[model samples]
Target: MAKFIINGGKKLSGEIKVSGSKNALFPIFAASLLTEQPCRISNVPEIVDKQVMVHLLADLGVQMNVSPHEVLITAANINKTDLNPELTSKLRGSVVLLGALLARMKRVTMSFPGGDSIGKRPIDSHLQAFEALGAITQANGVIEISAEKLVGNKIILEESSVTATENAILAGAMAEGQTVIKLAAMEPHVQQLCEFLNKMGAKITGIGTTTINITGVPKLHGAEIDLIPDSNEAASFITLAAATKSTVTVTGINPEYLDDFLLKLKNMAVNFEVGKDFIEVNAPTVDYQAIKIQGGLYPKLASDDIPAMAILATQAVGKSTMNEWMYENRLGYATELMKMGASVEAVDSHNVIFTGPTPLKGDKMTSSDIRMGITLVIAALVAQGQSEIEGVEHIDRGYENLEERLSKLGAEIRRA
Candidate 1:
């Protein structure tokens, strides 16, 4: 495993463009299977997860033309319905294919999906949604799902799970009848998937809302699309700028998607300006105030961004409370931060209390997960001494060329 050797206390400046959304691209990749024609997607980030996703698609006999930041996938002839167990286990996002494959071939078999060890991320929602859409599931260590003919039905998700909603939408897109989804996830990535499906001739309405309707078509045609800029990545850089009191402008960001996060930054008195497609963080306020932060469903702070917000809280003047009920171990990074001299108390599995204006000194740390890894990188950038962060692979899964990108922004970070 590669490690990041970062010399902290360096102010970062210059404009850094956020990469295409990893979350958005995964579903788009899976959705390509709905059509036999070629689907070309631009703005594809070269992340490890994308690599894994492409491999999985290739294993299914989809012909692909992949380049830096671009991919053209032609699922002209898919030879396999069973997902490769080893490849499928490496990526949690692989679960989205369950719906996509079912829509195309009506049969898919796979073992449990794997991802970061944040907490329990169950696929019960996916299976339940499929069952509601007239698919039968058999599970005994491995899962075998098949549908004779999918007929859409009203599905009220167990929770507003993004992937589950994507799965339901994918299956509903090609089902025989109209499918109604209530209490669906309205995340930006979910919206992107909906829009992309519509572009491919799937009739979907009530986008950006809890309730969505899909009129199933017999088949979906391939279409080209551009992936949206990753909001989580934009949030990470914004936090990095504020944590180090740097002047960094993050471009290619849709400010609308980051409203809650930006509001939190504004409340903290962090100096930042939001443009049509950019957010520039100037020198941070001298005495930033601590604020309460909660992670919830969309329009609220995203659970993925909670870790970066926690790092920002560490530099605030007063105590800040972090409530992340979405994942049990999302705040596991608090202990690693404590090692770097931050005042942190793990109040409970779901809550954390941070007391700040603490000068962090570099310490050895592990990256644990994607969000946790980037959070540590931001923390290390502002720390006093050099820090060695292991598990760079986890960071690469989400952020594309992160060390190289941050280095160009004047950060003294190097992959070792």
Candidate 2:
């Protein structure tokens, strides 16, 4: 039970470089199982989720050379087709391996995957997509998926689930014929996976759209790829800057990926500048009007960023609302914020109303999930007095070396 100790009322000023997207790397790493050639991926973040993925890959006999900045994976000699429930339960990203294993070995046995206890994130889409690819699926205590030959077909996901769409893509990349996916998730990370597979010789088109067409190739050759900077992490620092009324310059960002969040920042009257690879934010002296945040799909405010926006709303001039229609437990930290003197109320399981500019007082809190965990940290960093946040493990799953990075930016925070 590690904790983060923070001395509040520090104005975070200085430049901080965000790591590569952890979310982007998860599915791509699993998708690497589709190819026999050595795949080189750079700009990987060193986080708990990545380590868990590497551990899962090791169990499957994929030789990996992992470092702080990059990862080289060659699944040419995989010996196992089954992933254990223990490792898979650690992170939900493990479910993405289903399509890859089916693509390569044509058989896979596993239990239900797990990650955050946010809600009932069902893998029905993953199994449904696999069945669409001509695979036979069974369900007992364990799920057994097998196929004689993967034949591509059209798949229209039920709800544009990201991992389900990714599973279909991974399996479709190696299937026999053309695979058409309609109502696919058009997230930046999903697009990144499409681009990576294309570089690996899979002909994928209509990226960043609702419809994705994939032409299955016989074999995929390994290629080098770089991950895009994490927009969520970039947005985290920008929210901190505004909450503390400080100046922060975050480097290593692609401005286009963060257009929606930037628009909301502007609407909230937070002065900001975007460059080729950087975002500089300056907080105004007076609190600004409330801004409604719709935590929907990509090109919209993502669900992961909902908590941070709620934290920003606590210091806003008027009433602000955050609606996370995706997950029921996304507002778990709202009660925690109330402990810190924030006028935030969980209006429903999926929505929260924040009234500000309420003065926040530091207190003891715990991380509920990755997004909510960091949001609490940002609130604690700006609150009056000392704040201790339990559950560093949850925070480490997403952000890499958060305490050290924020420390460099003048935040008096340390792991304890």
Candidate 3:
């Protein structure tokens, strides 16, 4: 087990280049199974989740060449119909392969997928969409799905679930007719998947909306795609800048996705400058005001991000409420901040109220999930004295070389 020992009270100041979207790259990797040709994915993050996905692909006889930031996958000689359960259980994105396998081999058998224990994330939405498109599903302990042919039909998703919507689109892209998806997830990663499928000859419209239309293609060819930078990771850096009262530049961000979120942070008196492809966040000198935030589907603060925001709120002077409506257990990580002397109270499982300007003292902490783990690290950077953080694997599952990146920004953090 790896851990991070952070010597706190350092202002992070420097430029750090952001990596490709971990959320975007996983689905795209699974989508590679839809083609038998070679696919090149650039800007891939060298993280545990990506490694798990690559291992799963290799188990299916797909050849992969990986570097620090790029992956090339060729699936011309797939040899297995069953995905490795152990690998699949390591990350949530492993469920994405169900769509590709069902599309290509007409059958797939895999165990229940697992990842961070955030809450009850059901795969029923994925199954319902698959069954709607002419596939049969069987579940006892393991899940088995098979179909002779998938004929496209209109699918009104029960909820705007991101993974479920992506699974539906992947399955419907190769179906025989037109598939109209209502109440679909319009996250940026979903849009990237749609654009990627279109490049491979699948017809898809409504790239960034609640409803999507996909015309099935008999076969999809391999295409080259550059994954987008991770906005959530970038947001973490922005929050760190604000907490430490330092100026740092985050490079290679897509401005369109960040404008609204940055604007909200600015409203809280955080200063930042946005360029075409980068954002420079300057820390505030005076006591900052806490801002109320609500999490929603898209164009709202992402649920995965609320934990980090909660940590940032501890540095402000007033109280702030973060209402996380999506996941029930996400606010549990805030308790770690309270351990560091931050006045955070969990109103319920989903809501947390923060009373700020708490003089935090470094304490031993453990990471419950990826985002929260990193949030703890951010809190440690601003706290006084030394802090030991365990469960570093959770942090590495999303962020790549986080200690190295923070060190480049002059943070006193090291791996142990």
Model 2 CA lDDT for position 41: 89
Better of 2 and 3 by lDDT: 2
lDDT (Cα, tens digit) per residue for candidate 1, span 272-337: 998999999999656889999987889988998889888888989999999987889778789999
Per-residue lDDT of candidate 3, residues 196-255 (tens digit): 999989999988999999989999999999999999998888888787778999888886
Count clashing residue pairs in model 2: 0
Candidate 3: list runs displaced more than 4 Å: none
Q: Assess the local accuracy of residue 82 in candidate 3 as a C-alpha lDDT between 0 and 100.
A: 92
Among these predicted structures, which one has the highest lDDT?
A: 1
Task: Name the lDDT value of residue 411 in candidate 3.
Answer: 93
Q: Write the per-residue lDDT of candidate 2 for residues 11-126, one digit (tens) a residue.
A: 88999998999888888898788888899989999899999999999899999999878999999899999997899889888888988899999999988887787887987888
- Please report, as a residue range, the 10-residue window in candidate 1 with the lowest summed lDDT: 280-289
Q: Please estimate how well model 2 matches the true structure, expressed as its whole-model Cα lDDT.
A: 0.89
Report, for every candidate in turn, its global Cα lDDT versus the true structure. 0.92, 0.89, 0.88
Q: Where does model 1 exceed 4 Å of error? A: none
Worst 10 residues of 2 by lDDT: 280-289
User: Which segments of candidate 2 are over 4 A away from where they belong?
Assistant: none
Collision pairs in model 2: none
TM-score of decoy 3: 0.98
Name the candidate, 1 or 3, with the larger lDDT value: 1
Local error of candidate 3 at residue 338 (angstroms)? 1.2
Worst 10 residues of 3 by lDDT: 255-264
